[model samples]
Target: MAELPLSGLLVLDFSQFLAGPSCALRLADLGADVVKVERPQGGDLCRQLYVADLALDGDSALFHTINRNKRSVAADLKDPADLEAVKRLVARADVMIHNFRPGVMERLGLGFDAVAALNPRLVYGAVSGYGDEGPWRDKPGQDLLVQSLSGFVWLSGNADQGPTPAGVSVTDILTGAHLAQGILAALVRRGVTGRGGRVDVSLMESALDMQFEQLTTFLNTDRAQPRRSAVAHANVHIAAPYGVYQTADGYLALAMTPVDRLAELLDCAALEPFRDRSTWFIERDAIKAVIADHLMTRPTADWLAVLEAAGVWAAEVMTWPRLVEHDAFKALDVTQLIESAGGGTLLTTRCPIRIDGRILTSPRGAPRLGADTAAMLEEPMLDGNARVGE
Candidate 1:
């Protein structure tokens, strides 16, 4: 087997919930030994932060999904002894990550400055809701709040509809990805400079970054707000034919196809007047209305076949069941069944990245709280001179 990129590295995950733990999970996938440090009382709050009241082995299924392949050590920062032990672990860690609001880590004496002092070569990563400063810094960095505050909610849904946040925790997931990217970059720099650096990411920043293309256009175009289409629009900035239209049986998503070509294929005479490509955006709703009514006359498969045969980009919009059951999804091999320490199995998606043409996978699931405390505490310090936990 090829060696994983992050082999031999140790990551101390001092984060709770999604953003921080997800980052640590990726590092663990790449072969880093990730140790999740949690509060002694209940460990990470996510253990009980149930998503739809579903859990495995007494921990939320969501927690297991994000925290797979990690060991846990219960520690109370308020307790001087436990704090000292965590500091020692930090001193030995190659990477340390946290998503606490500003001032919390500093209050616990585990801020970047203090941790960096203990381990000069440590790559310290921090994720905040807004940023370390500004009026929103102290506010809770939850996903939905960040999405609403960052104008992300306005980007989805129809023009007449109320603001719609994404179905998933997009801000948290994107923030985690950004945090992982920054940590990787810092690690590369450390290899060259022999010095570690601090990586800072925020949910607001990540949410904005996800809208770079649309935001760029919005920013440069006289500060115009996104105008979602009246029809089944997928993106606010995209022109007509860039949406899902309901067919006789299901839905068919159309991409950037020529309106004339669609008119020829679908036999919709109304779309013929939309020959001018520039008018596609200006008269999107009218063109989409014609397309929508025409598509509803036929089933999704018939539309897809005709559109695909004509060299037009289109596909049948699929639900989770259809997607998972399809041969295409099976060929991708993106799903994995991970087993917890208690032997409970979880069906979850695996990492999308491939290293040396191999999909990354690990059988281990999320650890039980404090499961590795004694073992990790017995390991020698970074200098290999003594056991710091003693």
Candidate 2:
């Protein structure tokens, strides 16, 4: 069979929590051999991140979601024996990932320079809160804090409400993608140079990068930074009649920004009222005001059918259940279910990419703390003796 992209690569995942662990998870998903290094007890802190009822299960949904397809080895770094074991693991790993506060690794004797001396072919990836140096460097940063710091919190959500927490871990997810890219780039560099590289990414950097388009305009112009817009738009300033419209039962989105399209979609006599002058951008806010009042009459379902028939760019609001039940989703059915421990199955969304007509889906299961401890500790001892079962 053909080689998996990262088949021979080995990763030492010293990171816990969302961003760094999720990056390691992606590498594991792509067939890299990833060994997650965890504390001798308790494992990653994310194991306790959710609602309290699941505490009895001894496994967290978050932990399981981001930590599949990897083996786990537990160690107490302060102990000399454990530290020696970790050093041995680092010697064999192609990549090392960590998201500790700035000096924590150095304090633990696993700093990049120290490890790199032992293993020059190691790709060291680190994710942190603010960055290595900044006003918030030593201070802790989480998804909520960074979300508010980045204008994303204000940029999204309804105009009437104060900034609300995004339901998902936006910064962590973005940072994870960046971390993945950095690791992959290092891997590429290592292939050519025959030496590994150190790749450092931060949540703050990734969070700020997420607002590139908004920041570009705001910084260059005297205009006040755009705040909460009721609608989610790719080009918010240019969008008109460009929001979710209510139908009899649900919502149908309208992206009728182009004047001719807007005119036809709204079924109006003329858009002369909107195209008052060259200051149409200025008039857009008020135009939406008028259009909003008109859309108030119809329910979302009715508007959806009308828009669909009219060939207008529109989509019905998809709740979680709605998305699952949507015809396109049902027809395509991208997500799959995997059996878990205790004879239960876990439903999960599938990975997006396809390779030569094949979609790679790894077995999904949570680690049993230090379940791979014996195998990991004996890799060196077993050496040639380490057959598939060993």
Candidate 3:
């Protein structure tokens, strides 16, 4: 029943794809009034970015997932009238987010300096493939490309396997999270100084930050490339038993546990020689091979029962169907239902943050293209020098 943290702030989302829009989504989740400023022609290109060929209402499910609980106002930045309207909106916005290439927004006359001139308290956030003025600045800031360039693929999969990217858009999601963090920090600073600042994040930088543990180890060590375990590979830098192994029936994941304890627990004589802690990383592949072969003797449930009983960090690797059906997942109450444009409910995740022991839930779905354009333009203050939301 507590009021949301960002209740009165106005956020203008100018980006089309994942990173910038996702940051806006989080702000919207926290009760910020977020408005998507999109091109009138097609709205967000993500509206057509269908995943699993799924569409919700008129837009792709992917677009709906990131854009729910937000309003939309369409504009053509090149058109004088639309540009003026957007500038007015920017003048009233507390935060403005975009993922255009370094100089694109500058060319559009809506760059940070220009917007800052209109609203000194506006937090300007930008997302890119790489930092501005870098060779990669012009490269498309897509998730997969950033992951491939940031050495993230090398950290996953086995040494013998081909480079494998994560199934999800990990870089884009993390970059969005990083941008949100930077925006929040800037907002806090603005509360103190009465001035807003620019926050910049790149998918490549976020991808590197995600590997801080392994990257730091690589930097401090001999600087050799990390080698993934040939068997049950999970973490590139971790020792044996830190991976998912195939049981007789299904998969079981094991975290860091003492080899001698695991040997005694599983009654595997092969692991008796690996009791020395220092040799774990050096002999990880060999140890993982033995563990892999031994674990295949029992089903995942049997291993989980023994491991859980012994207080070992182990679990059955579950599929999405199994995970969603489990009581533990159900208890989290992670999903919410939003009413779509046509009066049907669309199931999506609720905001994960808990405030005052209450979860934030909203039934608002993504808006139609330019759904709020007239209303926004018709706001009485938009016609004058006065800030609209102020």
Q: Each model's TM-score, in the order given?
A: 0.96, 0.90, 0.96
All candidates in order of lDDT, best leading: 1, 3, 2
lDDT of each: 0.88, 0.74, 0.88
- Candidate 3, poorest ten consecutive residues by summed lDDT: 381-390
Q: Select the stronger candidate by lDDT from 1 and 2.
A: 1
Comparing 2 with 3 on TM-score, the higher-scoring candidate is 3
Misplaced by over 4 Å in model 1 are 378-390
lDDT of 2 at 301: 66
Task: For candidate 2, write residues 326-354 as lDDT tens digits.
Answer: 78888765766644454555566555555
Ten contiguous residues with the weakest lDDT in model 2: 381-390
How much is 159 displaced in model 3, in angstroms?
Answer: 1.0
> Which pairs clash in model 3?
none
Per-residue error for 369 in candidate 3, Å, reads 0.4
User: What is the per-residue lDDT of model 1 for residues 1-390, given as tens digits with 9 covering 90 to 100?
Assistant: 656888788899999999999999898888788889888789999999998898889999999999988888888889998899888888888999998889999999999899999999999999999999998889999999999998999988988899999999999998999999999999999999989999999999999999899889988898978899999878988889899899999999999988878888998988888999989999999999999999999899998888888889899999999999999999999988888999999998888887878788877789999988877765653321111111
